[model samples]
Target: MRCAARRCAGRRRRRRARGGRWRRPRRRARAEEGRGLVRGSSTPVRGAVLLYGLLAVGAVTWVLADRGTIDLWRHPEPLWRFPFAAGLAGGLVVGVVFGRIVAWLSRWAVRRTRWGAGLHEEFHALLGPLPDSDILLLAFLSAAAEECFFRGALQPTVGLVAASLMFGGMHLPVNKRFIVWTIEATVLGFALGALFWAGGQLAAPVAAHFTINYENLHFVRRYRPA
Candidate 1:
């Protein structure tokens, strides 16, 4: 009778152990789910701050450098009267080519899949609707600031690749957004860099960037939903 009682006790103990193990998983799962919620909820705000902050910092740095107070040593160049004009022409050519390629890729991709759809939606959300003045201001500021930073100072000393990476890095850390966008921005950065390097004038890339942005803004405003 004692042996049978001990066997019953063993069975009860095993049941209790199994119940405890199962209960643990439930608590762990709840904790994991809560963590996911917190991460997901905070990602967007964090990403925006990161991206916008980088751009703003880069702009401020460029502005300070331009004023000669921050004088980060850059390659000295002989002043040429025609550098501005040359840069303007060369920048336009490069901008047109790059713009066409981007547009074609966007068109080809947008019709085919969910990824394209999401890209389209995101693109529209970020830059689809704006007034003429807003477009002009955005184009001007972006052209002036980006050209000054990437093409003017960084590209001359660091080479095209480093400048490109810096430009891309400055646009970083979007929520679950692939680094591919950063790379793409880098390539665009390089193109502008090349324009400045080849033309030997900051004005060229700035003009080109402004023109490209204006066209892009116009196209999106016309075709995409707000």
Candidate 2:
């Protein structure tokens, strides 16, 4: 009877020891989880600060340098004499379709990667969708301002490849998809820069930019659940 009692006490002690061990690990795990949540919460703010800070610096430098603000003054030189508005309306229609295509591509790429879905989802959530009017205005302003800085002034002041690099870097703040996004922007930047240099006016890139946005924006947003 005494041996059985001792065995029972030994089993109880072992269980208590095991319970103690399990408690520490669970506590530690919870603490680590809390830390992870805190880090995740701060990442977006950090990303935003980094991005906007870069853009602000770029804008300030542009203002101080007095580079190509006159390009903004150069209004849209539509083909006034051509039949059917010289394809202005048609070009814009194409741009809308193009924008949707790019956005769709971005969504697919982002969703497929390991860390990409979070970046893609958060980007859309934070920035929200660009309204039709806003997209139009942004395309115009971006074509003018961006062209002035990147293509007109910077390319001539610097060089083609160098200007494209800066242009891509400046967008890195607003871009979430990292290397892929940068690559896409770089290609577009090179083409847009080339067009601006060739045309000596913002019309071509502006139309193209707006068209791309119009095309892709709809496709990207199409996936959103009703």
lDDT of the structure predicted as candidate 2: 0.55
Show the colliding residue pairs in model 1: 87-204
Regions of candidate 1 where Cα sits further than 4 Å from its true position: 1-116, 177-179
- Ten-residue region with minimum lDDT total, candidate 1: 36-45
Model 2 stretches with alpha carbons more than 4 Å out = 1-120, 173-176
Instruction: Give the alpha carbon lDDT tens digit for every residue of 22-104 in model 1.
Output: 99999986654444222332343234435444755764576466555443222235233344456456656766676566656
- TM-score for candidate 2, please give it: 0.48
Candidate 2 lDDT at 199 equals 47
Top lDDT model: 1
Cα lDDT over the full model 1:
0.61
- What number of clashing residue pairs does each candidate have, in the order they appear? 1, 14
User: How far is 77's C-alpha from truth in model 2 (Å)?
Assistant: 20
Top TM-score model: 1
